[model samples]
Target chain A: MVYDVSKLTDFHYSALKEISNIGIGNAATSLATMLGSEVKVMTPDLKVARIEEVAEFSGGADKLVSGVLMKLSGCVKGYMVMLLPPESAKLICNTITKEQDSDIKNPMNESLISEVGHILGSTYMTAFSDFLKIDVFASAPFHTYDMIGAIMDNILIQMSQEVEHAIILDTLFTLKGNDMHGKLLTLFDPISLELILEQVNALFR
Target chain B: MIVIGMADYAVTRSPEKLTTLGLGSCVGIALYDPVTKIGGLIHIMLPTIENARFTDNCAKFADSGIPYLIEQMIGIGAVRRRLVAKIAGGAKMFSFNSDASMNIGERNIQATKVVLSEMKVPIISEDVGKNYGRTVVLDTDTGVYYVKSAIKGENVI
Candidate 1:
């Protein structure tokens, strides 16, 4: 049997990967400057999966915090989830903490997942804005456990339709003299994908 | 708008309100007794029953945040018997997987209700459950709540 891979084109995928690179790079530069520390941002590993597959992708991970960004560019809008691993979480809180962050969970300290969300979202929005030469703004980020998993649940029960694939834009930031490592993520849904494709086609033409 | 961090709590008096936006499955519970008009809102993220995540404070735990909010309301002369409770958020977000990681919202709602009932606090109004996100606002000025859905219309939750 043959399968159809007609959801997105190879050129479009490549364009998305390249865009993620540039947008994440811009975010890294901005975040590094704000922290007054050395930041080494590395290229991200890309994944393209239908929003439904996110459940399968995550398997059964525990309730860890995720920094999510919801954005709308033209007609595309979905969330970009940045899962801040526990180790990276500590490193980030320590950077901002006047002293060592407690072993206990501190609501006062911002979750690393969201701190990167602010960084990456702002960065990506700026880059995309520069590309489209239009302005886009994301809402103030809030920290929540099981954010992606919960979102998936909401999608399945409420929309009851596949949310299409997400072009997973993942990047890593090494900051604070190389002691901090966190992921920068940008998830583009189908609506946003179409607009992005249109922009790419316009640019090439 | 007051941002009540995890494992944290905040209380408000008359003429002061607390609000937070973009609650994805987290629970935003408010407490007040109309007679005194002393109200408080506590937004909690995790269930934290066993404290594996280390959020043990009553102000941080739903079981605890609810009590603390009620106590504060009572302390300010709001009678516990007359206190009315309002709740919003706790949407079953990301429901693709039926696992511990994905059930936090439901868990938060269940846990909040359990604590409230045991404390004999009646939930006067509630806006809970759904796939959408919510922004919850508590008007300490009037002891009223307004919940806005990220995907749909706004209502009192």
Candidate 2:
């Protein structure tokens, strides 16, 4: 079935938002348990955007970000990216390594961050599967510290070959009573997006 | 300095620099004319524009972007015969399970070479095809292309 953006209604948006909220909520809990702190994850900002506009979605193209990317398959085929600004990365890494200020590139620090990413990705996948009642699995997570633009370009180039626009679900995270902040961005491929909408439409019928 | 976004191109004369950041499976094509000191850079995402849903942005694809960039350079005092090209940033950021579409980096490089050859522009230097991302900068003043990557550090092409 061809995916038509105009056919999407507020009901569809609300349903997707509810799913993402649950997913992010679980991820935040996993992060808090690891860091031994109270964590707060805000409601996700969901939208459909053109490929060129994605770089700006997480701030600017040149902004340096620590990203953990994973591929999802089974019920949905798409990608998930957990983005942490430099300050947030340092905070989490320092806490994990028990260092005053650990460098993100440090081997021990990098591994800790990757583990955190793995936890978050798994939590999100499980939440999605439970809500949709479909089988969803995520590949092993990969970590990268680079410009946000470059990280997203790698994913979007492959996606743009098939679709002009993508579903962007962005959520913010913060350490309670602290200044640390991070973001999680999940992008859905066209086929997967169509599948999701089809399921949601079927439910409303 | 001028920054070019994905699927975009820009032209500049001597004393100015053109740059494009975050090339992952996307090719950065830099064209320069030594005599005129004119330069152009394009960040092309796909190999071709055939059957594209959006054709208004010709710079988004290799087949159309390469020629468009060259034409823009010539319009601003760059001689086509004197133009030479440099390229960088077609990288396979992740290794998938033997899917041909996952090898977009290789295809982008191939398409770029074909387009440049068709335009009669000789490529002087290149840094392409790896498993990392790259940020490329082209100096119009000296026709030097600098490629920076996390794995390889930095290199001038």
Candidate 3:
């Protein structure tokens, strides 16, 4: 069956949105507890876009950002990317290491950021698995700091090889009373997306 | 400056630089003719068009994109004999999976070389096959390729 994004109904959209909300909500709770500060994760903005359009989606391709990417497998397979501008990355690193008096400039801070990515990926995956009643797992996170266009190109190539379009789930994270912000982008492979739609349709039946 | 997006290609003359960024498994093919100061860059995603259901975008595959880019350069007054190619990107960003599909970077590089060879275009330089992403910029005036990476800093080829 050919996967068509335009054929997706409002029910499918709402179901996916609800799932994303639940997953981010769970991640925020865990993140808040770990950092000893309130974390706010907003509902995701989901859309289907062409590969070329994605480079300009969050900002531009030249926008500098750091990304933690994880490959997902099992019932559904795809890539989940957590993106942060340099300042937002520094903010998260500082918040995570505040009690230890650690500095973002330290070399160890990169590993610290990876750890945060791991936690966030794991939390998000766990919630998705629990809600969907399916077995899904994410590989260890890989970190890269570069032009957002490049980071997105890597994932987009892999995706475009299979399909010309991607379902982009864009979510934002912020720490309460602070100016920190991070973006989480989840890209579902077309096959997995079809399975997801079927599963969602079954729920309605 | 002309920016080539993913699965796109463009040809330009001197005083105009062409650039493409974040090449993980995709390959960026840069062809330049020193005589005319004409340059072309193609950001290709897959290795071949054999399996592609659609081939409308010639810049999306190595086999078709390379030849198509060369033709464009020729159309813009770049002599075929004076053209030299410098390629970059094609890095394996993920390590956990050893699947054949995961080795796309190597395959893309190989396919690119084959196509360039068939087209009789000499590959003068290349920076490829690593675990890091790269951003490549081609200077049409000097026919020089600049490659930048997060881990390795920068290199001019």
Better of 1 and 3 by TM-score: 3
Please write out the lDDT profile of model 1 over residues A89-173, one tens digit for every residue. 6666666564575331456654544565677677777786687654556655645444334433333222212233555666777
lDDT tens digits by residue: candidate 2, B3-90:
9988999999999999998787889999999999999999999899998767888999999999989889989889999999999978
Ranking by TM-score: 3, 2, 1
The Cα error of candidate 1 at residue A161, in Å, is: 4.1
Clash number by candidate, in order: 13, 0, 1
Give per-residue CA lDDT, model 3, range A133-203, as digits (tens): 77889888877776676677667777776777788778888985758788877788667888887777776
Please write out the lDDT profile of model 3 over residues B1-157, one tens digit for every residue: 8888888999999999999876767899999999889999999888999978767788889999899998999998999988899999888766654886668888899999999999899999999988777888999999999998876888999
The DockQ-based CAPRI class assigned to model 3 is acceptable
Tell me the TM-score of candidate 2's A chain.
Answer: 0.94
Candidate 2: Cα lDDT at B8? 90
The DockQ value obtained for model 3 is 0.46
Q: Against the true two-chain complex, what DockQ does each candidate achieve?
A: 0.06, 0.53, 0.46
**Chain A, model 3: TM:** 0.92
Task: Sort every candidate by DockQ, greatest first.
Answer: 2, 3, 1
Considering DockQ, which of the candidate structures 2 and 3 is the better prediction for this target? 2
DockQ of 1: 0.06
CAPRI class assigned to model 2: medium
CA deviation > 4 Å runs, candidate 3: A99-108, A176-178, B99-101
TM-score of chain A of 1: 0.77
